[model samples]
Target: MPFTDHERAYLDAQHIGRLATTGPRGPQTRPVGFKLNTDGTVDIGGIRLSSTRKYRNIRERPDTEVSFIVDDLEPDGPGAIAPGWGRGVEIRGRAETLTDTDPPLAPGAFSREVIRIHPRRIISWNLDPAAPELRGRTA
Candidate 1:
C-alpha cells in the first residue's frame, strides 16, 4: 500500500480533505469529501462536482497533477506547552475526472462525479510516534 497503517486509518476516519489543482487562472484548493478506494486511490466528490473548477481542470488537462491532504490538530499530551500539535497525510499524484460511472464517496452527500487520484507520492507527519516527522516516500 502507498500509505502506512496509521496513515490509512487516519484517512479512513477523516471525512473532509483539501484537494489542490491547477487551473487556467492559477492553483485552486477546496474542501472535499473523499473515499479511500480499495485499490489505494483517493476519490473526491461533492454536490455539483461536475461544474466545479477542479473537475474542469482535470478534464481540460489530461495530465492533471493534484495534491490532497487530510489533517487535524492533535490534543496536547502531558507536558505539552500548547495545544497546537498536528497530524496528517498528503497524497500527490495525477487526477482524472470521472462522470456518471462511479458511485459517490458518500452516498446522498456527493454526486457520481468525482476526481480520482492515483498516488505517486505520499507524505505523512506525526501519524506514528515512532515514525519521523515529515516522512515522505514514493508510492
Candidate 2:
C-alpha cells in the first residue's frame, strides 16, 4: 500500500529481482523471477523452491529481513556525456514460503511452494517517472 504510483509502475515493468537472505555463513543473494501480486506481495516461483537456501533460512528465522531489488541498467555509450548508473527500486521485507497452489510452477517439480515478500520499505532513485496518479505523492 505504501508503493507510490510511479514505484508501482516501475515494479510492474520488471520481471526479475534479487532476493537477499540471511545465511549461516553470512548473506546469500540469488536472482529470482518474481510476480508482483495484486495484494502487494512478490511471489517468487521456482523449481525446488522449498529446498532453496533462501527458503531454508527464512523458515529457520521467520523474522529474517530480505531485500529485494529490481533495476534498469544502461551502458554508457562511447561518447556519452554522463555515466549511466543503474536505476531501480529496493524493497526490504519479510519472506515466507507459500505452498497452497495445486500445480507446481515448473515441470515435474515436487512442490508448488513460492516465496512471498511483504514489503516494509521501498527506496528508489531515478527509477520512476512523474505520473498523473502520483502528482501529489513522493517517490
Candidate 1 has a TM-score of 0.90
- For model 1, give the 10-residue run with minimal summed lDDT: 74-83
TM-score of each: 0.90, 0.77
- In the range 1-139, model 1's lDDT, one tens digit per residue, is 7888888888999999999999999999999988898789998889889899888988999786899999888778863322587788999999998888464476776777888999999999878767647899999
The CA-based lDDT of model 2 is what?
0.73
lDDT of each: 0.85, 0.73
- lDDT (Cα, 0-100) at 40 in candidate 2: 77
